[model samples]
Target: MEKIILIGDSGHAKVIEDCIRSQGGSVIAKLDDRYQERFYEEHLIKGPIALIDDLLIDDVKIVISIGSNHIRKSIVERLNIADEKYATIIHNRAIVCNSVKVDYGTVIMPGVIVNADASIGCHSIINSNSVIEHDCVVENFTHISPGAILTGNVKVGQGSHVGAGATVIPGIDIGSWTTIGAGSSVISNIESNVTAVGIPAKVIKREGL
Candidate 1:
């Protein structure tokens, strides 16, 4: 089994850890400040983030357990981590098309259907049964919640989230850090950092729209 280091101790980190273990990867260490000597005793792990290079015992891959795209991108950039070596974490049951581009650190859950030419950004989550049509673009750190559907040529921005069962029309552009509510229908463009809801997705938070 390959050794993997989880890079956080938050609740999301715990979930990622469980996911990793479920995939049959060994958790060599956790790279969080919150866990100190106590973590060592509890998990029998020896290293942390500060000692990342030191803990390379051959055939080890690092996974950023951060939920936010900004945080994940920032850490990866700061560490100068190579995209070539970074692991892309996909559940065994995900169905990705041959022509799709899935970046590193992205998590594709079960029942996801990414059609031809769809681009799933790094560290993004395509949740269960989400349907991404051909030529759709999902930027880094974005989450396509369960049962969401994006028509062809749709662009979902970085750090944005499309809630469960939402449907985005074809050729629409959704900006970064935005949130589309559950069961909403997006007929128009959604700007950055706004929270939109309802059919046709009106801007609820104007400051970021």
Candidate 2:
């Protein structure tokens, strides 16, 4: 079992912790900016993010475990450790095919179905019950939220968020830093740095560069 150090403590982290436990790993420490330096639980330590290097050691891997794609990517940049020290967590219940490519720091939550030749990139999150169909390419730091579905040959760019219950049809390309609103049906390509909502997914806002 891996001795893990988790960074972040939101509700998302709770699920990530469960995913870790399901993989036979133990979360020995949790670091977040909100907590004071103390033992929050028996055999567990809780402290600020500044305590990261002090707590990290050999045989202990780290997980950002945060829900925000931008913040997760920011922290990933801040972490001085080698990529090999980052942990990729997949819930035991996820049905990932043999041809799927899962990179470091990614998390595949319970009930996720990643079909053949799907490529999940580094630091990405495939949240609970999400279905990533064949040849889907999810880039780094992306989050496919709960109940989201990406059909065959879909390409999701880096730092994107497919909101809960969203559906991107086959061959759709979602650009980087984009957000597809919850329950939206994306039938066409969504460009970068925009928020799209409604059925057929129209861009409602373009984020500043």
Number of the top-ranking candidate, with lDDT as the measure: 2
Candidate 1: regions farther than 4 A off: 14-24, 41-48, 207-209
Count of backbone clashes, every candidate in sequence: 0, 0
**116-201 in candidate 2: lDDT tens per residue?**
99999999999999999999999999999999999999999999999999999999999999999999999999999999999989
How does residue 95 of candidate 1 score in lDDT? 78
- lDDT: worst 10-residue window of model 1: 35-44
TM-score of decoy 2: 0.97
Candidate 2 C-alpha error for residue 143, in Å: 0.6
What tens-digit string does per-residue lDDT give for candidate 1 at 80-151? 866665667666667788899999887777778889999988878787789999999999889888899999
lDDT comparing candidate 1 with the true structure = 0.81
Worst 10 residues of 2 by lDDT: 35-44
